[model samples]
Target: MREATHDPATPLATGLSPAELRLLLSFAYTGAVAGPWPAVLEAAETSLRYQAWGLLTLCLDVFTRGLTPETGLDVLAFAVAYGLAQVGRVAEDYILATFPSVVATPAFLDLPAHLLIRLLRSDGLNVLHELEALEAASRWLMANGNGQEDLAKEVLSSVRFALMSGRELKKVPSVAAGVADPKVLRELMVESLAPMAQLPCRVRSLQEVLVVCGGDKLTANLAARKPSRHLWFAHRYLSAVGLVKRVEWRALGHFPDGPRFRHAVAVVGNILYVLGGKCYYGVRDTLASVYRYQPMDDSWERLASMTCGRSYFAAVALGDFIYALGGSSGEIYCTDTVECYDLTPAFPCPRRCQPLPMALCGHAACALDGTLYVSGGCDEACQCQASLLRYSPGEPAKLLAPMNGQRAGHIMEEAGGQLYVAGGLCQRDGQTGYRDQLAFEVYSPKLDIWVLLSPLPHAHVAGGAAVLGGELLVLGGYSHETYKDTHLIHAYQPGTRRWITRGTLPHAYTDFQACVLTVPPALQWVPPVVSGNPPPPGYMP
Candidate 1:
């Protein structure tokens, strides 16, 4: 034991050995010394062990500047022990970003069970798949013994089993065998397979949004020639900051054989029901065939055909029924026909409902509180009209207040007891050349009135629109000036009452359809850990 002058001002005069005292004094006075860093670090480590945390932190602040992957783990362990969350986060990120392979090292396996749990529970850990994280957690639990079973259960709970595919879940038993209780593990599996409405865990774990297909560049290029079979899903993810969202357009399964456009799409539970549309540019190419898509498995199955072939129609889901309204049938330019399909049965067929007061096509429709509302479309003469129709059960269609403008190919979505209509072709001043309209309007069912709101930033035609998370999202469509297709995604903020461009689609699409449904979160990749540097000053384990 060596000691120097006892001044309360200098806290370093405590129990340091001669070598540590000399090294520390030299570093404090001159900020430079000629000794092995390892020796100096050992003294700092001793200070940490003795609970001289202030002195240890001072030493680490000066020396931790040159930390490498090897030393990062030590510092991380120390920071974690001392509850220095920010410091631990930096060290963890550095290790994962630089020396990811360290996660597989024996040292990682030896991390205290509690520390392992903390790491696993961190949302920042971006593992390639939840299964990989599960495996690591399982390994740590097994090494620690069943005594940590409670902790192991808590650790495993953070794993997003619902996000895993059926194939991936099959491997859970093999990997989770000794780590989690059989009953607990079985509960997780059951939750994953449970219906979306009845899901007990992470009830809103997956954030689902509207997916638009076929309005892209591929569809435009093939429009004049032949239809394209390719289709894509526009997936949206909210970033950590919450201010900006990212959209990734992934390749969903394609349409069967012949591709179609101007189709009507509606979502009933998890299934997407697609109605009639034109398969080709030819007048005779109008299709009556219907199909349904299951996003979970990316499978499409043909459904019973509609009563009549049509294109540019509107479809809406009201409870267990889907209502398909007016559109053009090949020979007939426009029709007032309305049909409803009951999806409660295994194999369903469409039945004709009371026709509209007047024949119309290229219209927009939505169902709210058991009433069907249709607005702004081309009439029997194929001319744009400002007509609005309301149909209730056991009653004939009733004409409501007309829209401000004559709109065709517009989109309608209902939210918070109001109907929002945006983007379409409008005929003003009796002009033959139809103009693309940017005007946005909302209708209140209770008041039977239409109110003008902020117009779209970009005037689009035949775009797919839906209400998601209380915000209005308008997907890919085309503009008149360019006469070109656009993949632009525009979202309207209710708070601001303004439309902001969220992001562009992978490809521009027009006349495509979109619907929102809840699905699993996509998988991501996480980095690894490593070793080499000594533990930070005062680090316990």
Candidate 2:
């Protein structure tokens, strides 16, 4: 028999052998929680230092019926620390809501300040009175936590708001976002009403609304700093829409001039990324530009003067380049030309790429590595296109296998290297025209064939699709009569062949485009190991 250590300070190896440790590692890695794990919980906690997530990780596999006392805190810490952000942040909520011993301070919040703040946020502050003591625990944490930490301030803010209602009903956006006060809100409303007698033609602008809305940093808001044309419309529109209980646009100053952005715009790396099309009139005509919005200063700058100014263009970003595919580029075809913009240098003017294989304008394009796959656009004949084409780097575009049917204005996504096509218009026999498609298709490069997958729950098209943490998210787009108002994000898991609905976006949009910039393979998942366990959970294909 092996002799035990005489010194209590010295590390003591439990009776479990190295072979048993190896077996526990195997169960944790594969999530094969069907059978019993031989080792006790203490052994697993010790391994967390080496595995870096040994405790919580094992718990994630066995969380429900699986959460042993040993693995609970570790799992919560692990999920919070890594920002284990998933679709709907389901994993995060599971950890916070289910953990039995997670209320401990400083150490329990193993996350960075920002993450800790997020974990504690709650909206609607309505909870059952039974859990009041547990809910009030947030106040204790805020008081005990360090003042220097932003998380402490954030938590204190939430506690203040939550205490008023005494509830834990909502998984709010984040505490760092600042909690609101009812008393402050009422005072702000009176102050906003103070300004209502001022501009008439200012009918609708963001400025009027901001001045009256009474946000936390109202003085520093865009309307107060450098007012835009929409500032006027913002106030008037809100009041007219009954959003503002009693407010008028006349309180704000003169509305500003031409073409100001009216949406949540962004500029990643360089390509001027804009969302939610807005119309700004010139002196003579009401012209709407495909506004290339700049995030640096929230400025709206036009790109390429747009051969045709139209919303709902199919946008696909690859490498550092953005290819604006088919939409109404005016004159029948969105010009069949793929407008490629180099986003790195943040070009003042966009440089157009050569036209696509042909003028199948308004098509969907999906990028895999450097090659772009284009499909489903209207052709010169004015018929919806279902022909598929592949565009490789430095190579001319060529047609590949066509979809099983004709679908223009469809949505495209990729999983497991196979392209997934969502709902759109599909015409059979060139007769009975259908506004929306109930079917979907998958294209396999190896097989060089198209296979039909499960049909969509509802009919829609031109929606935005993104693969986040391995789930292919297909969001809102144009439906039959009007642009779909719902963000309607759905996640497609190739493994289970399932489509699960997720949380909606901050604002619903069909005119906008969404491109998920994935961190390269090296950084996204784990680095290559010679031979060991499979990849981490939820890695993109």
Off by over 4 Å in 2: 1-267, 270-272, 275-297, 302-304, 307-312, 344-348, 414-418, 444-451, 468-470, 478-496, 503-510, 514-541
How many clashes in each candidate? Answer: 15, 22
Lowest summed lDDT window (length 10), candidate 2: 206-215
- In model 1, which runs have C-alpha deviations exceeding 4 angstroms? 1-206, 216-231, 236-246, 521-541
Question: Which candidate comes out best when scored by TM-score?
Answer: 1
TM for every model, in the order presented, reads 0.58, 0.46
lDDT of 1 at 344: 88
The most accurate candidate by lDDT is 1
Please provide, for model 1 over 1-541, each residue's C-alpha lDDT reduced to its tens digit, 9 standing for 90 to 100. Answer: 1335444344454555655656566656675444555664565666666665655666566445544534556677777776767767767754443322345555666676666666665544534345666787777678775666678777787666754546567889999887777888888667655556132332111245456655434534465534445555544332222333445445555787477888888888888888889887788988899888887777888888998899988888899899988899888988988888999889888999888888888899999888889898888776888878897655888899988888888899987578989888887565567888888999988898999998888877888887754467787778775686666778776544667666766566788887776543431111111134453332222
Candidate 2's C-alpha lDDT? 0.46
Measured over all alpha carbons after superposition, the RMSD of each candidate to the real structure, in angstroms, is 21.7, 16.3
